[model samples]
Target: MAAENRAFVGSIVVAGAILVAGSPFLMGFLQKWESGKARVLVVYADPLAGGLPTVCNGLTRHVTSTPIIVGERWTDEQCDAEERSAVVAVQKRLAPCFKRPPSQMVFDMATSHAWNLGPAATCGSGAMTAWNRGQWTLGCQRIARGDDGTLVWSYTCKTVGGQRQCTFVQGLANRRADEAQTCGEVL
Candidate 1:
């Protein structure tokens, strides 16, 4: 009986080891999740919408347009250059805070998230801690909630009495989801 019990225990241990080794494959990544694909991530967060002044993070300014006067427009080249410059500034602010320096795409996404969400949300919140602790996906998800916690991407709005009343912004939520996904991806 003792011999048989020993064999059974050995078999269980072997099976457990195999399961652990194969866990990553089951989870869809070859290893633990950690992504920083800034370049690709930026594409998802910031799409080209023409050379017009836009409001982001409650600041009405044009990254692509200099002076950002009302009704001012910019060339695609100017916009692209300015956007890149803005990303650089964001990267500089966030890079040092990350426990692991993210890949370019991840960095870009985070920068875009900050740009879209707000500066207070980027480094001065749980997202920063998440990035430092490798729980960045969760951090990014939290970022979607905003500083006041008034929004949730998971919830949408309906037309109430023909008035568009909403507690959530679908686009913003999607952006946050993309950021979180990008952050959790394996580089």
Candidate 2:
């Protein structure tokens, strides 16, 4: 099983290393959002927003064959392998949603959005609708902001005046903006 896992990672590394028409590698670009820790798990939760247990590369689940535990440790290689595997799985799950083939940049951005949000949300998003129509710029813009110009998928629920309301998070907004820039990059 160890040998098989290593072999699988080897293949992913090869595929990940190949440049797609000067586009950034998905894993490397994704690192800007999902940082890696070599020797420990990075677990965090938003006080108001609520979050899940996350490991290397923002992974919440399927980090390993065994279920992940809080405060568990992992090697750099382990983290890298699992991260690549997760990225591949996300890509595959999101593949059928696009009616037209996307450029590498667009595809990577879409995958990044889905990585933060779930695949179900991404599939039903207006961005997905625009992409399905081959409207790349519109889709990219929509990834960060809605038609009303408010940030999307960057909100976390917070209690305001004793009522829970969704509020924008600067960090998540920043990530969305960066993704939008990358997706909007002119080839």
Candidate 3:
């Protein structure tokens, strides 16, 4: 009995020592946002917004104890967490729909688009079909293709107070350009 007790105590000490040795790296990892490097994709997905029922990548489910007000705000940390969750969820949702493996950047780009649209829209999209066929550049074009069925950045213009105003659609032209180039695609 005494021998067994000693062995058990020795095992505990070894285990404790290992934990002590690993604590610094473990703590650093714990302090990091859970998404790791992919969190950058989430940040890119969630645009800065100053409104409640806020749209982050077009996913709007943030709710607090009380009703979310117009000025209900989120810290960078909070927003990161939320966006990371959305990216992960949508990624999982769309994962099985991919016909072929994608590079990490391409997958991140897909996650960004899926966030802006819904998972259903993304998964069932022609973009998904094209990507599944390993037609990456074509898929990317479909992903960024505007409502006019063209790969062009479009904006809505309105006449307010008899003055014409055009709102660039989230600077989407830049996003499309970035994604296309990353995928070695041109439109």
Model 1 lDDT per residue over 129-173, tens place: 666676655665565555466444434445689997656446556
Model 3: how far is 8 from its true place, Å?
36
- What TM-score, computed on C-alpha atoms, does each candidate reach? 0.51, 0.77, 0.52
Clashing pairs in 2: none
TM-score (C-alpha) between model 1 and the true structure: 0.51
Q: Write the per-residue lDDT of candidate 2 for residues 97-145, one digit (tens) a residue.
A: 8777777778778888888887778889989999888788999999999
Once fitted onto the true fold, the runs of candidate 2 whose alpha carbons sit more than 4 angstroms away are 1-24, 36-51, 62-65, 158-164
Query: In candidate 3, which residue pairs clash?
Result: none
Q: Specify the highest-lDDT model's number.
A: 2
Q: Candidates 1 and 2: which is better by TM-score?
A: 2
Candidate lDDT values, in order: 0.43, 0.68, 0.47
Model 1 clash tally? 9
Which one is best on TM-score? 2
TM match of model 2 to true structure: 0.77
